[model samples]
Target: MASAVKDSRSGYGTLLRTPGAWTFLLPGFLARQPFAMLTIGIVLLVQSTTGSYGTAGAVSATTGVAMALFAPQGGKLADRFGQRAVLLPGVLVHAAGVAALITLALAHAPLWALLAVAVPTGASTPQVGPMVRARWAARLGAGPLMPTAAAFESVTDEFTFVVGPVLATALCTGIHPAAGLVAEAALTLAGGLLFAAQKRSQPAVHRPGSGERPRVSALSVPGVRVLIVAFLGIGAVFGGMQVSLTAFTQHIGQPGINGVLYGIFAGGNMLAGIACGAITWKVGPRRRLLVAYGLLALATTPLWAVTAVPLLGAVGLVVGLCIAPALITGYTLVETLVPATARTEAFTWLTGAVALGQAAAATSAGQLADGFGPSTGFLVPLAGTALACTVLLALRAHLLPRRSAGGAEAAAGHLPAQVSAGAEDRERELARA
Candidate 1:
């Protein structure tokens, strides 16, 4: 019985039992690395070619805005037109945008041209993380399996952040930035196409209720709104961390080794995510979230003290470990709170919040680093996390209908039960239709 209980908690065990799980999960991990490489490569290429950090930054900003603003619409389109219909067009558009950005950057076209091209690039890019999570939830119907899947997604994301920069830097510096962009375009097209091609990967179709439009905005939902704010804070912390790392590495006379150090940092996050999945069942969601955020704040403070390269790297790894579980817990909370009709959009909003926060932190921290030295970059994430903690703490009572997440006892009223009913009703109708 003890062995059976242990096996039940194993993420791989749960995944093995779920039919068609691999068809969806496999593409995400495989496709993400290439996609991340391309995305980072393009960003590096654009920034290098333009010779204007401001313009390059603006392009990123445009992309974030597009992603945040149009994410729900994109999700809605998926609901209305099927995953393939939404995904293929978005991929082609992204391919075209990358081509244009590369051409313009190579040709030394005006900065405005790049920004114009970039907005759509950002907007059209599918919500890869959210889509994957939603698909998993749709398949497994959420239990211990959901946390395991969340760990997988977080670890994959960490890996992408770790490797993509190195690949981008190597390709851009070794060959030409344009070569990197071209590679990115190809990967995006292939990954997007491949993901769309899998029949099991399609989002479950739902029957609409009376007075419900096929199209709806996630902004209209209260729980989604709070989650978005939380994600924004999270994004800010991440962006600040990236800028801080870049500046700190350069400051310590090892600008060249920043990528390698970042990889180590990412490795810690991956480890933390995997571990979190195994133990998350033991802690209630609220406590896990509170502890994660509190620890993240504490982890960040030591960077302000470390001066030596070895110490910095060690401190960074410790700090990075706090990120994944915090993120996973936050996402799980959203799943438990958001309405079925708005789940996709809510997830997108969370993604957008993070993107926006990252962009904001990057800009602010980069500027501060430029003026006051790289060490100043720590100020961004340090303050960002502090603010995030305060805000979350202040709003904890109302964030999600006062339910205890991951607790064995269900709340009297909560969104997860509603989602379950919706899924059941939709499944029945699909059989009939």
Candidate 2:
């Protein structure tokens, strides 16, 4: 049993050893950090200049909404064109937009001007996370290493969330209100350019003569739509926690403890992501996703009733632990349910769903905390997951790949010929690893 466990954990090491993997992985990490930093940086700078949290949140929401709306489109373009073609101009535009936003905030410009610039700032943000996942798919195909890669990427994402806000907060508070944005812009430009230059790692573009069928929107896939809804619920958990934890700390008269509480939650997520990537499971990703999400809902149920700090921290840790498995499994399912051609767009859609869900939950939870109490805010996570769990139960069949008359996997549209062969055995092997 111990030997099996060690073998399972070695999967990540095997995946990282893929030649040329580090070239893109390093730049991708740097580029993806901006996604976690942008909203917080904007909030800090705008609040410092205007002395209004309300105004600051509004600007940040504008950025989030814009990013959610436009990210899939960017992914679609990258699919039809190439990652470099889209990302090169995207990083430049994003940098300019961030500069404009910082300049406007410092000049005390009207909310309208800030909103205008926020659109481009968010829309032009490089789709590095999705692009990186697409690269993993292209490089690894439908192999055992794919799942490990997904888990690794989730761990990377969790780490960024942990680090990005802290770094942004420190820069804005300790250095200058504009320092966070400045650092964010610099990272986006440098990291994005470096990531884009790795053409060998980028997924092949599906042009007319590339022998690929005309690209379709990833949303057309039934499974992709279902996953989006599931992800939205997951986003609610994050958003609810952010607001509720703050309100809870304030309610307890130790508002400063909010950061520490949230850190415990995020830390659990990172640890779980690492462990999840290390251990090979015997269950299929579809089954694992359902089970993980159910556990997530169950974990969140007790949150509204907890008041003590230590107890809250423990529950938060459990809830965070539940999150990474569901997330990693969901991304793994995308490989089986979406075609290679639209995989990047599918990834972006799931990511966008999470952002949109988080924004909505934060807004609703904040209002609830203000009207009722922090405990009421905690209800958002439970409600979100419960509602999503219901949908997942009702339409769980959609999560499976479609098989054709010959008993071959259809996988939404179609996978590359090489990936289609023996896909099930590979998936089962991945599960057992």
Candidate 3:
């Protein structure tokens, strides 16, 4: 047992020591927390204040759509200009939007006013988390540490989801919603700026040979298309999950219970992600990714059976078990499949797919919950997961990486100097793809 524990610790220790790894992971975690917090907080606060869940859902949906539409552009900017250049403007735009949200709420502005403000706020969304993940691909050269890095990113996402709502709920209810939004804005500013300050965190983009025209499209890549589908499916699940908590709360005749439920759901993802990161695996990446998706599908099934709020929260915790590992593995695969130059764009595409999924889910879930009832709305994600599973299976051949024949030679080639050369190769491949 002691030996096992030591082995586990040592494994994580190696990951922690990887150059530029911690720098990329930690700041993005901090930055992403506020994004999750503000999103949940604003929806709850608006719904509570205006006594109209529909309007709140609409605002949230709008945010999701805007995020989806603009994310690809954000990725392009990050790649072409630089992470710092792209990030600074995004931070400011997000901050400004949040300020508008706070002001409108405090001023008792009409619902339309809030919706209008939420659009730009979503557009100016930071690329910090996506950029950070891309940086890992550049730094680590994509292998064992890729899973660890992806797990780190997933856990951070889960952690934010867990804490964001709780903090937002407490602040909005305890103090003022405006105050909560302001605080979220501040964190975005600070975190985005801080994240940008780290020179090593920027993604390495290599310009191709003379007269080489820019790549026409990321969609041309078979791997990118597969990953995008997975992202969209997962995104739909995430968006539906958010709405489902509220649906569960309302169904239980205790609308306030969603905060607790969501917190539990996010909590499960956080713990599972951390544990997944700690484990060292010799299994092939394709097999690991398949298992992750399968677990996600299996874990989601029990969620529909939950009726009571407490039971709902408990079941959600169990459902969350597969989320982080699945996401981490998927992201790791994305890093392997996509080239370096298009890395940021690829990440953005991933984010956009998720945003589109989230938006679609939010709209559909909200309407279903408000019209037919919350129970059916809760089941939509289950169906979405089944769809996702089919997509994963169908796309498996293209999405999964092939086992390299060189074995030890391939493994050893992932060091620092190799990282630079690999990035250059990735750029050329991305251009061609």
Candidate 4:
């Protein structure tokens, strides 16, 4: 047991030890906080100023939709030009947009005006998470370390979600209504600039050579499409749990416990992410993704029936624990299935899909909770994951890339130099086993 524990942890130790890894990772973490903070910050500030949750939600939804639509375009540009070129301008525009939105909100500007500024704010939000993943792929390549990196990033994402909302809420309530947006803008500007400046670690831009095929959109790949839908289901689980937990607490006459219950759920996700990163997996990522997703479906199946708070918390934690493996495995498959050139774009697609899905689920779940009950609201996640799992199982073949004349997938050679080295290392490890 001790040997297994040490083996599980060694992957992260070695991954973090990679030379120059910290340069971008630190700033990336700082920059990513705004993603978690943005929607909640907007909702809080707008609700305080306008005195209507409906209006605030509309404005926030506008921002989310704009971000979801434009993030992939930014990723494509990053792949074509370079991360620095895109990120520098993106961060600046986002900061300026945030400033404008805050000012307009304080002045009690028209809803249309706030919505207009929101477009730029969200559209210009830096694609920091996807860019960081691209850096890891460039630095570590298609190797065992890549899975560890994906797990670490997933953990980071879960952490930001856990922290960001709390921070935003505190700033909006304790400090000033605009404090959350102000802090979000400041982080975006500072962290994004620092991250963008790390040119040494950025993926090399892969412009087509003469007579080569023109670069295509990442969505053209069937596998990317499948993964996007799968991610959407994961997002639904998040949205559903948030609403259902809040309603459950309110229903039980202990509204304050909503935060605690939700914390337990998200904490489980973070712990699972840490553990998933530590273990050295023998099973391939494709199999892991399917199994993890199925388990997620199974775990969520009982949510609608739980009446006791303790049982609810226990079930929510188990559901949270099931999420990380699916998320990490899905990301690992991206490294193998997509070419290096379009990888950042592919990551952004998945990220955006999650955002879109979360927004939709939250809206629908909120309605179900309001109209029917908290228990009915819990159905959204179960329905979402089960439906997505069906699609994933039906289209599982698209997950694997086609082999080319050179006896490797077309994407195999397009990867970084470290990929071939990692393949060789895998062969040695297998032989030893």
Number of the top-ranking candidate, with TM-score as the measure: 2
After TM-score superposition, what is the CA distance of residue 304 in candidate 2 from its true location, in Å?
Answer: 3.7
Per-model C-alpha RMSD: 7.2, 4.2, 6.3, 4.9
Q: What is residue 10's positional error in candidate 1, in angstroms?
A: 4.4
| Candidate number with greatest lDDT | 2
- Give lDDT per model, in order: 0.66, 0.82, 0.71, 0.80
Q: Give the lDDT of residue 407 in candidate 4.
A: 41
Provide the lowest-lDDT 10-residue window in model 2.
1-10
Q: In model 4, which runs have C-alpha deviations exceeding 4 angstroms?
A: 1-10, 49-54, 104-111, 243-259, 304-311, 369-376, 407-433
Q: Candidate 3, after superposition: displacement of residue 394 in Å?
A: 1.9
Which candidate order results from sorting by TM-score in descending order?
2, 4, 3, 1
Q: Whole-model lDDT, candidate 3? A: 0.71
Number of clashes recorded per candidate: 0, 2, 0, 0
Clashes of 4: 0
Estimate candidate 2's RMSD in Å: 4.2
TM-score of candidate 1 to 2 decimals: 0.84
lDDT of 1 by residue, 346-413 (tens): 67778778777777776677677767877776777777777888777666543443333463112221
Error of 4 at 202 (Å): 1.0
Q: Tally clashing residue pairs in candidate 3.
A: 0
